[model samples]
Target: MSPPTRRSPRSRPSPEAAEPNGTFDAATRQQIDAVVAALHELYPDADCELAWETPLDLLIATILSAQSTDARVNQVTRDLFSRYRTASDYADADVAELEEEIRSTGFYRQKAKNLIGAGEILRDRFAGEVPRTIDELTEVPGAARKTANVVLGTAYGIPSGFVVDTHVKRLAHRLGLSAETRPEKIESDLMARIPRDEWIFAAHALIWHGRRVCHARRPQCGDCGLADHCPRNGL
Candidate 1:
């Protein structure tokens, strides 16, 4: 018998392809489409806020962004990226020194550890290059699906899945698009309702709305264009 062949890293299937079909009714589908359209009009240039020059930079910045803001992560990475230019640099870095370097980001010990371990994996397994697929990218120590999606979609222009950060999760529920709280479940709900091409932009636009308008403590309903269509669930 022939051994089962592994799929090429570049050919990783989009989340939209694997999601269950017909999750949205005709009315609901129209509502979601309208919501997405409004968001596009409001934030036509929405994109990843984290600054990165390469996939490795994005991966590292994303890992550091856990429980932290993108502004904070970028502040830390300005010095961090300049010091460690490549995955190999991180792989060979002193853990103690690295921890101190990223201390301001909070959870420095774990973040530094993940950075080193991920670097080692990249150097050993993927020839010191960032993997293009969600499956392969998630193999790095700090990268879960959220981080992988950020790197793949933002860095490589591959729409692997919708990025479900805190903003996405909160906005999804508030807009009545997703009843779930967990990021993964919320992402699934969104993928089922939103079109394939809009996945990446949708995440960025939602994130921008959450940050600029639909704030956690005080969502500016009057300032929001979606206020009319939104069910305002849990708000």
Candidate 2:
């Protein structure tokens, strides 16, 4: 009998795709397309779940969303946006009051301080507005890859990198698209596999998939549109 053929790294998806969600090995091309198409069918209009009236809302919400759900972040920011419209608003927010308001989001004390600091930086450095570039966004007190991804992708229409949220990180692994365990490493892997053009929306699609069908605790793989294409189908 012939020995089983071994696939090469070039034959596997890149450690990370590009800025747009493109490029993949043969196995992954169809799989990614199927995942994207399903998202198109189910949501049809993939968008950011964090509620925001302006760039600053999205930025602050992204900061607050750390270790929390977007729904909960939105709940906390329901009127938080109306009251704190600019970076300076957060800069001036009474520390205790800010902590109390954002207390439900978890890690309230840290988040509140970061919010105030980020706002202060934005006001001083960028004139009270969020920056458009990743470098600029990262200058904020609490901004990280995930937060920067949100700000760069949603607020500025810039796709510097994939957003590696809990959903993106998990779905990427389950879909056999990336092998990295850490979020930054996974983002790097994805940047090499996916095309640059689809980066922003691709993250959104995977996020929606992770939430709706590919749940963390119990993914509904049986009903998943990409079941056949999913290597981790039973997950």
Top lDDT hit? 1
lDDT of each: 0.83, 0.79
The 10-residue segment with the lowest total lDDT in model 2: 3-12
Best by TM-score: 1
Taking all chains together, the TM-score of candidate 1 against the true structure is 0.89
TM-score of each: 0.89, 0.87
lDDT of 2 by residue, 1-235 (tens): 2211111101222234454545556766766767666667776667688877678878888899998998899878886876787788899999999999999999999999999999899999999888887777787888876788777788778887889888898989888878889887888877767667677878888898888989989999778877877788895
Model 1 residue 49 CA deviation (Å) reads: 0.5
TM-score of 2: 0.87
With candidate 2 superimposed using the best TM-score fit, by how many Å does residue 200's alpha carbon deviate from the native? 0.8
> Candidate 1, residues 1-235: lDDT per residue as tens digits?
2211111112334444434334667788778889999999999888888877777888899899998888888888888888887889999999999999889889999999999999999999999999988889988998988999988888888888889988899888888888987777788788877777888888989999999999999889988888877898336
